[model samples]
Target: GDARGAGRPTGERSGRPTGDARGAGRPGEARRDSGYRGTGNPAADRYAAKKSGAGKPRQKPSGPRAFGGERFGKDLGPVRRPKAARTSRPADELDMHNPDGVRLQKVMASAGVASRRVCEEMILDGRVEVDGTIVRELGVRVVPSEVSIHVDGMRLQLNEDLKYYVFNKPRGVISTMEDPEGRPSIGNFLKNKNKNERLFHVGRLDAETEGLLLLTNDGELTNRLTHPSYEVPKTYYVQVRGPMGPGIGAQMKEGIELEDGISKVDSFKLIDSTPGHILVEVVLHSGKNRVVRRLFDAVGHPVERLVRTQIGPIRLNDQRQGSIRVLGRQEVGHLLASVGL
Candidate 1:
């Protein structure tokens, strides 16, 4: 009987069960069914069939419909993004419209009253007067020949004939024009020439370290040449106490922090080496006091003797020690051009 049921057509078994199999249906139902048990009323049977999903299993959506096309409860549409702000024009692109006459502080600084920054401070403090009127405002431009500038009740005398000189500063000679200790100074070398004009040294070399020194009456050029902002390279020949190790040059070139600030050598080259001493040529733009000596001392190799061989375009090749000579027009021009003067 089980073999016969298995071989029977699916329609015959699906319709109704016979005899004892009919007992599987509920008491009120007329037939046993695989899905929803049908009621006698046609409308009720149709409702039951619809509620039970009488035919095939429900299928999911195929592609995009699986994910509802909505974001944060709103229908997704074209995305709106913000635009970037426009940038300002570069400095070079701006119009080149400069006012006439020299800046007030600049003129005062050029007259050897003080450095540019100090002159600005003086102006701000109401210590500077122009044309008999107290002018504290910066950026006030005036012609040197026309205006009367006074600092601390003393009138400034603008030096029309600015002179530039290269002096081979000798050892034991101070770098200043005057010293309270009555030490031999650069003024001793400049006495014969420009007797009345006051000149200032561009940079300083210690009394024991002798080399090329620039003396100028042009305070503006002095400020530009010596100011760290210009980064004018100064070359020096340094003799240390012992032979420099192989990695010393690399270390110096990298940089070292000192008490004042970090110091870095732009270029370092080992000139000669011996068991007793090491000679090195170092180029740097720093204008710190005793910077070269401090750098060597920091590396455990104290500098025995140091000499500045070059400053920007100027060189102290064969200039006799204790001798001073006026810089040629071409040399002066080159030096000025080096600092964008």
Candidate 2:
């Protein structure tokens, strides 16, 4: 049986020595735990540990000087418990009920998202949020048009009164909703639409020049879209009577002096060319009367045809002439965000 430090008591301790008592004796040797020298046989190990006065709890040894040292007893410090994980309050626990507002499910149904029963289930499954907070309670209520809502991560427009549409105004159709002379106007195209609700054309497309025009009942949106401060770009596909001269794009982009102001294209790209004509795309933020026509006239190339293709983030891609199309929910969201609405 081993006989090293056998008489040492369990509770007693001292400064770290060159080697622990369980290790084989050699004054200058590094300390090793009992496991390093232990025999594979359990019975033999037990007998040896019994003789070596081990298998009893001893004082925790100071860690290496590298851990926290300049002193003999300094260690890595006490094992600490981590901060408690933050937990959100359960949906049902928060006060979501609004006695005066419409029920959440009903609002969802009214917005054409789903039927009341399905919307309720969706809420209970945590698929609905009101102003960024998930709502699971069936009794929650919100003013239909006052709060921002989302289902399955897509924003839902709750205001039924507000409507938006993109109209493909064919050439020669007046941009106004109605004209006294009974010429082809926007009103003629909307005769079959809901008659009671008033709609406003967002911006004008002159009687002879037409393409994409926005129509909506959202008055504030209309005002901002027309306001020059927003500088919303409009893209046009233009055809001009040209011998296709060089530097026209650069000169137009640099700015063309007119009676109103120095007008310029944000971008000018040559699309196609032939012996007698040039077709190009021009983007600019100017909302002046007959701006495109005058810009081309200044450059000595008369505008043969002009068709606006885009406004802000809205595109008039392949829409049939004189057809009216409703804006999708995401499209409306993007439109609203474009003007900081």
TM-score top scorer: 2
Flag clash pairs in model 1. none
Residues 50-119 of candidate 2: C-alpha lDDT, one tens digit per residue? 6765645556656443344333433745544333343545534555556788889998887777789999
Q: Which runs in model 1 stand beyond 4 Å of their true positions? A: 1-160
- Output the lDDT of residue 304, model 1: 87
Candidate 2: misplaced stretches above 4 Å? 1-141, 149-156
Superposition error at 317 for model 1 (Å)? 0.9
> Which 10 successive residues of model 1 have the least lDDT summed?
89-98
Compare the candidates by lDDT and give the number of the best one. 2
lDDT of each: 0.76, 0.79
What is the per-residue lDDT of model 1 for residues 143-187, given as tens digits with 9 covering 90 to 100?
787776667666665545879888988889988887899999877
The count of residue-pair clashes in candidate 1 stands at 0
